[model samples]
Target: MQFTSGYGAEPGAWRLPGANLRSYTDMDQFVRYAQAAERGKIQLLFFADTPVLDVDLERQVPHFAIDPLLVMTSIARETERIGLVSTASTTFNEPYSLARQFKALDVISHGRAGWNAVTTSDPAAAANFGRAVPPRAEKYERAHEVLQIVQALWGSWEKDAWVLDVDGKRFADMDRIQPVDLQGRHVASRGPLPIPPSEQGQPVIFQAGGGGYGLELAGRYADGVYANPYTIEDGQAQRQALRDAAERAGRDPDEVKMFAGFMPAIAGSRRAALDRRRFLDESVDLRQRVRYLGAMIGLPLGYRQIDEPLTADQLADAVPSPHDPRSARALEVAREGWTLRDVLAHGVIDYHPVVAGTATDVADHMQQWFEAGACDGFSLAIDGYHDGVDAFVDQVVPLLQERGLFHLDYEGPTLRDHLHAREQYGLDPRVTETAAR
Candidate 1:
């Protein structure tokens, strides 16, 4: 499972701010967290973004985090080897600015940066962006167009575009760097972006939309996928589907890595793990529980009971995860009576999987899934405060290293180099340059 640092607003943490990070009011604190994770040889540091604030998560949950990109900019200067990922929404932001920001990050980080492509789904985001309501099918189309434009911009400067011609008194060969005449359906542009292609070419693409169109688009282009994995069997099945889709889309399936969002709450003993699990289950407020349940089942906000029997239809309706309106997810949770506590307790099942146990046990589950080809890795979305990340890095991570399942130290300087160390960087050099119009 891929570990992600969100959900908590933790204070007094050394490595990462816990899920509830409301207490961490320091800007430099985020930098400290990223630096510490790098010391652990953690592979990737990721963040997610929303165009607008909705459901009053801060009022509901413990804390709300900062802008992922800005935080990563600080990380770019302070850390090395650890892959830095930023989440950006194509729905609200323009492609040009988004492309430029990610490119600049890639350059400053020495290619340790990646962009998680997303479509803004929150209703409040629509309001924030001058839309009365969210657009459904159109958003995916816009994302596709945005991806196309961004890639072209990244490729605008050819490998030899900036050869200095001192004798000729020229800075670059204009012929080598050409505009990309991209007439997008929703988003379009001309480019050879102001910045040349960085050492890593461009930041890697990470995707998480689970719908068919989103999966196909990601399959065609993304380097990694951030996904929700319930069971090992389910993850394997999803992996297979992604592989098949890649084949159909005429891309190499191996090019994309899977980082399932998982919540593994580790403890020294089975009893301790269980106790921690219980505390988490009972800790959440009850109304939030109803909202969470409705969200999960894709039902509208309404009445539900704790002991209410879940129906096949209700469960089926809720099973389809919503990408845009939190309302759809909220409705499902409430109508089905999936309380906040249950939502938190289920972890990866209804929630992302939360593994609560000793280091050995937690590593065992991670290994089982890895060897099974269910996922390449997991992004941990551990519970609040600092204990969750602390235990993971100190306990579970060490075991993974001992088993040779994870890296004891980073192999390369760049995120792309580290992720695909043995792979060729110029594998698609020709794909990098399209003549300017």
Candidate 2:
């Protein structure tokens, strides 16, 4: 599950009753949240990031307050079993340093760390990095090279590279260590990585993207793929697309796991859940929603006629901005012939599937999607105060476990153990062999 700080992508979540306004900065609170996830045996706790103040300063609460790596480092000390996935942009960071940092984290967390590689889209982030944003094609090309270099560096040291001999006065088998003398068009790195492999090998690689380049990167390298599938059909199509991409790249399709983003306004009862969703929707300003709709449709939508449904032609022609890839979900909702108000209330702008129901209802939705081959798993977005996290862990998780859809306890200690359980169950022969190696 992914939650950096505060409610994920919800502008009005901080203002909810009993919400923690200080969640963005509280280290103790983050530890508590991580522990809650560990209790439910969640495979990964993902942290999304950008190196800029991306949130709206006037209205929205600050989300990415602390660096993700730092927060994960703290949580690493607090939790033992749950995996820590920290976001690092290929756009801003150099490959050698990024690889070394995550390798160190993997060591610290005892193979329970994951690197969420991202090509940042926020234009403002370029100013912080002291460069102009590269063109989309150029950015993706660089990202590909960066990932390649990082992976090569991670594998530079062989499993038996460290001899640790004192009497022989040799600490490492120099012959076993190979230098990654990569001279790629976008980035280059030299020499074998200094750190030895952790118990789970290197940190697991994760990638999130909607475009072709992004999908290709995930298929080629990512062990886990973070995705935004707005509906069941979208999820199935994305899952098949990723599997196709993996096969085209000469990989086992089952090795690449898809994790769809999910944010639900859950309550004890179905009626209460709907009421909670309504309250959350009403908290946001109408003008902001109008702006969101206009951005999604790539047109100037007037708030005066917010109740009127957009014309079919307008919805059909709507092409999302390359930077704002999530706009497609809003366009999808618009294609359903819903009015601007209804689309806004549905919160399609965040580009995640939303559910509002009791624990049983939530479990049913998840089970249906899983059984239908919609996605491998869900990357839950917890509420700001952690109420959602507690509720899901305390309620929905047990129900799923009872149905034999979820694990009653963690199968093993390392993140790879948690992730590779499906492979061990015979999802793919090569993947099982690779995990064993």
Candidate 3:
């Protein structure tokens, strides 16, 4: 299965009880972490991004303090094979500029670059862009238009467009480079990009969103999908829905690889891992937890007591208008009768699948998911930067390889190459071909 090392610091990550991890500001730690992921032959080092800070919650490190592309560029210099996937928002960025930046990254990394396309969902991000948050429909409409222009610009130049012929005094085949000439309601581009395609064509497209519109966007164009399916059944259902959407979009379903986010707390034994998980959960303050939950539900829960049980009436009253993905999930949880105390104690804020176990135990769960066709791979969202990453790479990866569930070594030097490597394990090869186009 494909693996991506999620490199970022979230709330309670650095300040976890009894934890001695370095702060997110430590560049040396980031570099070393990338190296460790490469050593394990992990496919990508994925960086999550946010456009602005929401003051309602507190975090030790500022979210989006360092630009994701800049971070990826620095990491690119340190590692040779692992793909560098940077998040960029379609809501705030101009399509041409964003396309140009990703192209440069792809070239510099020798074609091991990917773009995680996102429409900034936070209201704070809208304020940073000097406007109020647009309606959900409008944001998605803009996103679809932005992606069209970006892809068109990337494909404007033919493979053989550039020619260095000093003898003939010709620099490039001008006729081979066509203008994008795109015009949409939300976005537009006038001509071809300044640069040609990198060794592996354009940077791979990775999409992470929720709800119907998000799934449709991913199916239409994304080469990879970053998803959050908490159970095997959930994963299987989501994967099927994505495939169906791809078919409806007139694209090969296999072209889009769905990767579920998995955060594992690994240790020498399952018991030790569970203990560490408990300590980490206790690190976050009660206020922070309430605020986080409130954000998910799109309601104000900061006034609520942490130890108190939430009534069904209160949950129903808190249901957010417009019904965005996260809010819908929160409503579902509330409908299931989860109380405030249960939410806090069960670590519900981190919604992705959490597996705490020994190396063998972790591998077993992963194998079950893979065999069940629940996901193409997983995005490894470990708790700590140094120790968390090292533990998985050194211990768990070997076990996965021994079980024939993961790759043993690099097959090629590009992100596409790593993604297509899955075909050997019974996936259809046509998906890679369609992705290359």
Candidate 4:
């Protein structure tokens, strides 16, 4: 199965109970983490970025402080096999510029670069770009256009376009270069990208979003998907839905790999792991939890007592912010006439399924999900900088390898090669073609 390290250096990442790691801002720690992941043969080191500050700056880590692509560039020289994926917003960036940057990264990394496509969701980012936030539909519409233009630009230079002929005094074949004269309702671009395609084609595209619009975009163009499925059943349904959408889009379903998020708190034994989980869970302050609940519901719940039962009227008064996708979950709970404590009890707010156990126990859960066709692999969410990742690499990876559920060594170079390696494992070919049936 494909393995990706979802670097958790952002604000709330450090707030988990029992977390004693240093700040993610420490470059030394970050580099060490990347090296450890590479040693474990993780396929991708994925970074989640925001164009503007969206969280409480005083309480949370500012994600925008460092540009992910630049950081990836630094890591590129330190490792050879692991893939580097960076997030870029179609809403805030022009297609041509984004294309050029990724092309450069792909070249520098020898075709191991990936771009995580995102239409900026934080309304505050609009101000940074000096514009009002567009409606959700409009943002996605623009994103679709942006993607087309970027792909066109990346294809502008044909293979073998570059010819260094000393006798002819020629640098490139003019006939082979073509302009991408594109004009759509939301975007327009006319150009041939200056950079040619890297050794492995354009940087692999990764996309993440919630709801239908997001899924449709991923189905149409993404090579890999960072999905949010909180249950095994939910994961199965989402994977099937993505494949169905791919069929309708006239794309090969197997080409689109689905990666569900996973965070494991492992120890020597299952009981010890449970104890660690309890410590971490209890470490989270009530105020912070209430604030998170407010963000999910799109309104503050600070005034209400933690144990107070929420009324429909109170919920109805608190309208969901158009930008936050998780607001739907809070609304669902409020509609059920549940108490504030119920929201905390269900743990419905987390993006991924958390598994707490021994290495074998964790491996068993992962095996069950994979065999059940829940996802192509997992994007591991780390709790600590060094300790968290090191534990899994040392303990969990060997178990997965022993079970023949994961790769023993580097299969091939390039992110595309790593993603396509799944075909060799005898996965059901029909998994991606389920929509046709």
> What C-alpha lDDT values do all the predictions have?
0.66, 0.79, 0.74, 0.73
Kindly list the per-residue Cα lDDT of model 1 for residues 281-385, writing each as its tens digit.
Answer: 553455665555556555553444544545557555655454532334344444445444443343423356556668898899889889999898787765643
Clashing pairs in 4: 11-61
| Superposed Cα deviation of residue 1, candidate 1 (Å) | 8.9
Which residue pairs clash in candidate 3? none
List clash counts for every candidate, in order: 43, 0, 0, 1
Which lDDT tens digits does candidate 3 get at residues 315-379? 76675445333445445656666566455433455667666678777788788998999999998
- Candidate 3 versus the native: TM-score? 0.80
> What CA root-mean-square deviation does each model show from the true structure?
6.7, 5.7, 6.7, 7.4
Model 2, range 1-437, lDDT digits (tens) per residue? 77766554466667778776777888888888889888888888988888988767687666674788888988999899999998899988999999899988988999888888989877899889888788888888898778878877888888888999999999999887889798878889996789888878788888888789888877777789988887788889999999998876768788889998887667887567755655666656788778767876688888876777888667667787656656767787777776777666555665577666788888998999998899999988754445878888989899999999999888788888888822211023343244345
Models 1 onward score TM values of 0.78, 0.83, 0.80, 0.79
User: lDDT rank, highest first?
Assistant: 2, 3, 4, 1
**Whole-model alpha-carbon lDDT for candidate 1:** 0.66
Q: Is candidate 2 or candidate 4 better by lDDT?
A: 2
- When 3 and 4 are scored with lDDT, the better candidate is 3
